[model samples]
Target: MDFDALRRHPDLEAPGLAAADAADRLILDESASALAEVAGPPGSVVVIDDAYGALALGAMDAGARGVRVHQDPVTGERALAENAERLGLAVDERPAALPLGAGLLAGARVVLMRLPRSLDRLDEVAGLIATHASTDVRVFAGGRLKHMSLAMNDVLGRWFERVDVTHARQKSRVLVASGPRQGPASDWPRSARDDELGIEVVAHGGVFAGTGVDIGTRFLLGVLGDAVPDAATAVDLACGSGVVAAWLARERPRLVVRASDRSAAAAASAPLTAVANGVGERVEVTRADGLEHLPDASERLVVLNPPFHSDAAVHTGIATHLFAEAARVLAPGGELWCVWNSHLRYRPLLERIVGPTRQVARNPKFTVTASARRAASPLS
Candidate 1:
């Protein structure tokens, strides 16, 4: 159905909230029937994030007195707030809009979560919920049928009560869970290693290469140690679990290393990695959409492993935006170093934005490129 038709349909309004991108594919539904089957009403505190806003709105419409909606601090904060206003509900004043980690669910009675597309991060969310949710709390999670996997169900069952599947409707299915509270937070097994760059790296589940350091990152770290200039400020752009940023701080203890990601969970996990490695004082973690919050020309070095796929789709929009933003925020002569899939075309984009891009290193699967801000360029 088209967005216009969905907006005009009276039945769609029954969800108490409706969301559609330009495509209008019923992005989310939080109707009374849906919420009733998932989480019962009255005094329950309902929490929804991203596409799950419709469900939270439905619960509110179905007589839920308190509802807290979480959005990834990096991307969904604005949209979630706008969604709340659209439904005529007051936004929560607490720091409840960020990612709903274990700390955020301390008092939630019921949670209706829309599973994210990144399966790598699911364990982190499950671990958080398991740690915080009471035994009596009901956690109902749903996703498109195609995205649901046996492993996903297994992960949910490990942390929550019994897991039961609901019939698919509108191409989505729900996993209903209830049980005794099991709060052992051993979700992500840690593997520690001292890299060649004088940094001790500890990785957890969901962090890229959580099982072991990715060869691409290890290659980039080696290059960074050799090429990084003596600068006061640097940033690890897509810092997955704080490996590169923590390494930078360990190698150059006086330099301020800032780490950022679009995932609130990644940002939350980064500082812990830094603290574990004893470089917490030198590292600052921010949840951001690529350089959005950084001042123009503020950093002398920007290191990244630009992601090619957002969820399951192969897209370069994020990498393109990061290059543009990196160029904008780099000090004159500042360097942008990035590693990407060898098949992905990023060199031209880097050249167009940062000027005189060069290949620093390459492996069978990935290529590392470096570009320096032009001192006399228009961007400068």
Candidate 2:
């Protein structure tokens, strides 16, 4: 299979960003024998966190039938579907998309996973497989050596009795784990109270910043009180765990706040946070790509603490995409309140993409800006 033929559309696509990498190829090659053994059942092969359709499609191409797949980000999910269509993979042969749950792993013979960066996420996933997958199932978890660590092996040790590391190929390696250890049920989607912010935060392992507040979000929360006071409805674009949405709804009793994120974990955690904070009635959460679900000029206020990284790479394209979405979603006189790293200096881009922009607040590390939407502004 030509792995490089895959495209990362619906995701930020740049020359530097690839839909498939050496890691994906290395994983497929390392697991080729195991995949070939998965002949009888439809879901005998399971692929987790495939950045695109690489692992799932590759498995199907390698004669693995009924491949089940789960991807954290909605863009990755969409990209996989589109890639399958582009590659002319028959509907019956394409991988079945599933959520990260027992059903996804039940009766699985071979599991291929792209190792997640977060140890918490890895723990949760490993726990799920150990608890649900077949007793004799083998897991092939692979990633670049630069991103892999001894800590990952330790995490896997908790669930699997044996873990064998494969030799590095093009800076990528696979960890083959078997002998599932009987263990306690997973305790994921943890919750904690932030006394300083007077809010309860709930999070799944895949959520950014986990259950505690990050420094950047803390800074943004401080200035949220002044964002478009008269707007009856507000949006929390790229909302992670619904902190901004919950805070807005709690502070303004009558305001209707909608929170949207691309991450499945964030979408699942946000509503729980809202409910815990006693703002569930007014807070709406959606799992979507940017603000695509929203109509043009339909919102008066939007708050964002945009992410700067795409996977492990430090890319500003994500932040810029969110800014353009905020501009499109905001009403003519609406405002976009955003907090970003001080060094990025997004004021000029905000001015060009949204409208008149001014610095609202600034700390040594973070800068908060307010950009009023212009009736007509070009979206870059």
Candidate 3:
């Protein structure tokens, strides 16, 4: 398969990573039967966490009839759609990311995936495949050796009777597993009480930071005690697990809140977090890309703890793009509350991109800043 034909979304750029990686090729090469299954009938093969269009398009190129695919990032899904149209290929795309179930896996004899970094995520996926896919299902999971670990083997072993590792090729390797064994039902969407906040934090396996609140967010929350503007509507941009959004809704009962993220798991888990905190009715969660759909200067407040990494690559553009979008959607006197690692030095950039930025609070590691949508004067 000519994997180089694939391309990442135009909006995303990571320094070391290309449009397609060697693991994608290794996966397609190692799973001949699976590729054939995808070409022969629908639901015989399913692809998960494909970074772009590589796996699905590669299957189509190999004469696959119908390939069902799920991508965790909005950019990846859009890139796949764009590539499919560019290549004139038809792919049976899932409506959302990682919607693991019988509809996606039923009668599927083969599962192809580019392994995710989170072992918890892999655990959930492996369990789902073993439980929902055909009893004869064979899973081909591949990734870079640096990203792969013995723990993945252990995780897959929990759900499959056999897990074997292939020799490394081009810095990538595949884990071949079969003999699906029935396991207990999923333990995801788990919730735990937050004693300090007097609410619950709910999370799925794939959510960012995890079930507990991270220190960066915790610090941001501490500063937000009196920071969130009094407004009719506010957004928790890139809301992971919806802790901030739920808190905002509870703090201001009248404010309608929107919690959004690029990951389907995060978006799906947000509402649960809200409901767990008794604010579900006021908090609206969505899987979206950077609040791009909101009209110009329509939002009175926005809060963000933008992710610093893109996939495994440390990329600041992700945060910068969100800042631009926040500036666009925020009303004239609106505020964009942001928290980031102190070392990233985002205040200057924030001032330039949005408007005047002032430090609200800072810890040794994180610095919280609130920038106005359009200040009286732009920062020099």
Candidate 4:
């Protein structure tokens, strides 16, 4: 696929999420070289964790047919499909949308994976490949050296018999591994009880901080109802792992809550978290970009810990975008309670986007604020 042939989905809601990056180019180039050197049987080429279409389509360009792929983020998955159609190459996008399962690697001889930031997530990916891939499968994983770590080697070492590190190129490195080994059962979706919340948290590999609560969400949970008093329905916007959703459902049995995020993994994890906490049927979980799936002025309260980064870049537009979503969804006199990094100083922006905003709580690193929508004009 020509680099020019690819594009991030025009409708992707993220502000700073890139369509493709240097590491993507590096992985494809390195994988091509590795295959050329080894001259191995090539069928069922798979790309894992590709943020967009670069790896899979790049493989397609290199004469690999039936390239199966998996992207953990829903947005990334959509982008790959949209880019594939944009290329107009007899586009049957079924391969691009394959999940992480036998169908994805029934006979995978070669795999290209973009390294994830979390060691646990990497362990999950590597372990799945070792368990499902054909014996001759060669996995080429690459990442920027700055974000890559020694722990990654150890994680891959657990599943692959041998892990070979390639020389760095453009500050990016590829890990070439073969010889899948059978190992102990994977401990995916690990669960633990949070005594403070009096509920269990079952987190999949992609969940943040594993089973432990993030400090920002923890702070936000401490003051949930205060932000939108008397509101019957509440939303956990950008609900990562659904800690807030579970907590709210348990705290207010009458509360109707929804947890929504852009990541398929996170969206899947939220329901698991609810089931672990015995609130499965009570809380609704949906994978969505902001409040696109919800109607205007339908939500009475929205609790958010808006992510500052769009992919890897530190961008405030992500938070601003979420603020705008809250402004659109919240009912008249409804409120949006948000927790964010103090340094970001989201107060003024919140006032402009969601209406009169005030600091509800503060600490050394994080600030919690509540912005009430004007009763006159929900849009305004």
Q: Among these predicted structures, which one has the highest TM-score? A: 2
Name model 4 segments beyond 4 Å from true: 10-18, 33-43, 376-380
Q: Once model 4 is optimally superposed onto the true structure by TM-score, how far is the C-alpha of residue 227 displaced, in angstroms?
A: 3.2
lDDT of 3 at 87: 73
What lDDT does model 1 reach? 0.67
Q: How close to the true structure is residue 67 of candidate 1, measured as C-alpha lDDT?
A: 58
Q: Tens digit of lDDT per residue, candidate 2, span 208-231?
A: 889988898899989888889989
TM of each candidate vs. truth: 0.81, 0.97, 0.94, 0.93
Give per-residue CA lDDT, model 3, range 10-92, as digits (tens): 54765566878888888888997666655666557778888887877776667654567778778888988887777765444
Runs with alpha carbons beyond 4 Å of true place in candidate 3: 90-98, 375-380
The full ranking of all candidates by lDDT, starting with the best, is: 2, 3, 4, 1
| Residue 355 alpha-carbon offset, candidate 4, angstroms | 1.1
Model 1 TM-score (2 dp): 0.81
The Cα error of candidate 4 at residue 35, in Å, is 5.7
Candidate 2: C-alpha RMSD after superposition: 1.7
Model 1 residue 319 CA deviation (Å) reads 0.9
The most accurate candidate by lDDT is: 2
Prediction 2 TM-score vs. true = 0.97
Put the candidates in TM-score order, highest first. 2, 3, 4, 1
